[model samples]
Target: MALLTVKNLSVGYHTRKGFLKSVQGVSFSLDQGKSLGLVGESGCGKTTIGMALMGLLPDNASVTDGMILFEDQDLLKMSKKEIRQVRWKKVAMIFQAAMNALNPVHRVSEQISEAILAHDADISEKAAMKQVESLFDLVGIPQDRMRDYPHHYSGGMKQRAIIAMALACHPSLIIADEPTTALDVIVQDQILSAIKDFQNKLKISVIFISHDIAVVADVCDNIGIMFAGQLVEYGRIEEVFDAPMHPYTKSLLASYLTLDKDVVQLNSYIGETFDLINSTTGCRFCERCSVAEATCSLVAPEWVEISPTHKALCYQCK
Candidate 1:
């Protein structure tokens, strides 16, 4: 069974004018000990999907349609109390900004212990502390700095601390939403390597969300491309990168710089930003698509499989 399955997931925000859908019909599944990368430009609903899965959407935002199933159990259908039980213990999340995610006032160890205690009531203070230390060690954080507050740690250290907190409960799935965004290239490599090591050791599934296609390409087994609140393409990482069928996917891969290759100008098909509120009919990417036809402006595209494991949502592909 899949560790996580999101089907027909749609998220919307209540605005002054009306409800504006941010994530429309986003669907995918992750298996145990596997990683799936969610890649898209900013405002393409990558983060929204992550938040919806964790039930962390803002008050105005909600999952209007779809099911988030973890191990065949529908998370959307679970009660608030039941969802609470699953949050840290079964599904943990590493926020985009790890520094901001950590509490400035509390010591690092304390924060990690709190997460552990919240999930496992039988775990005493001493056991939680031991687990926190073990997590610190696992994430390559020094034991001596366990009592230090968030402010005392460097940017990378703070990120490692956040990762430690997330792993305190030994979750089955970890959703890392741009976990290495603000860090430098070297630190980003270190953090990602650490995450991979932990995933392998624990046999945990990961949903890695990032706009950095290069980063995702390195770590994920599968890739799902999103554009204007919809999944445009999905397939095995090698297949998607090696022979991308979707125009958007092709454009994204072209933007990356490979070994000994000069940087290529990224195809900017989309304008400044996509207006999800005004979008009601037709293909959401019609205005930006270079290969769009009159039919694209008149109707939404359907997802069709082009290969055994590859699928795309485009009339041209069909």
Candidate 2:
């Protein structure tokens, strides 16, 4: 069975204007030891999806409809207390801002050890400290530096520390929301490499969320492209990157400036921002889609299969 399955998940935020639908009917599945990347432009509901999966949505937001099944159990159906019991022990999150997430006053070792002790009460402090030290080793942080406060570590090191804390309970799944964001290219590469190696070694599943298509391409096995609060395309990394069926996906790749491209090419999507408060009945990208026709404005597109495992929401594909 798939380790995690999210079906027909819709989420919205309550704003002064109205209830703004952020994520609409999004669905995907991830098997054990595999990684799925959620990529899209900002305000496309990418982070909202991650927050929903982690059950960390704000007071103004809610899951309007859907099922989040983790290990065949319905997470959406579970009580808050039940979900809390499952959170760090079964699944953990490496939040977007590691520095902000870490306690500024506490030493890194204490913070990680506290997570370990909170989940496993029987584990002695010495044993928990040992586990923290081991995690420090795994993430390539020196053991002696574990006693340092969050302010003592660099951006990359803080990220690694957050990764280590996420692995404290040895959870089966990890939701990494822009874990490498705001870091230099070299530091980003290092963190990605470390996470990749750790995932392989531990055989853990991951939901890697990022706006950077290149970063997602580097770490994910499968790619799900989101736009205007919907999943527009999904397929294997190579398939989606090499032969993107959705116009939005194509535009994303076109906008990305890769080193191999001999000619300098920059492309931008031309249209109004996505309408969430007063959403249209037709395709959300209809206004911006370069190839959209009259029918695209009148009717929504269904998922059209390109291969057994690849599909895109486009009437032209159908």
Among all candidates shown, the one with the greatest TM-score: 2
| Alpha-carbon runs more than 4 Å astray in model 1 | 264-266
| Candidate 1 per-residue C-alpha lDDT over 168-260 given as tens digits, one digit per residue, 9 for 90 to 100 | 898999999999998999999999999999999999899999999999988899999999899999999999988887888888888777887
Model 1, residue 46: C-alpha shift (Å) = 1.0
| Index of the highest-lDDT prediction | 2
Q: What global local distance difference test value does model 2 have? A: 0.92
Which residue runs of candidate 2 sit more than 4 Å off their true CA positions? none
TM of each candidate vs. truth? 0.97, 0.98
Tens digits of lDDT, candidate 2, 193-279? 988998999999999999999999999999999999999999999999999999999989989987888656588768788989999
- Provide the clashing-pair count of each candidate structure: 0, 0
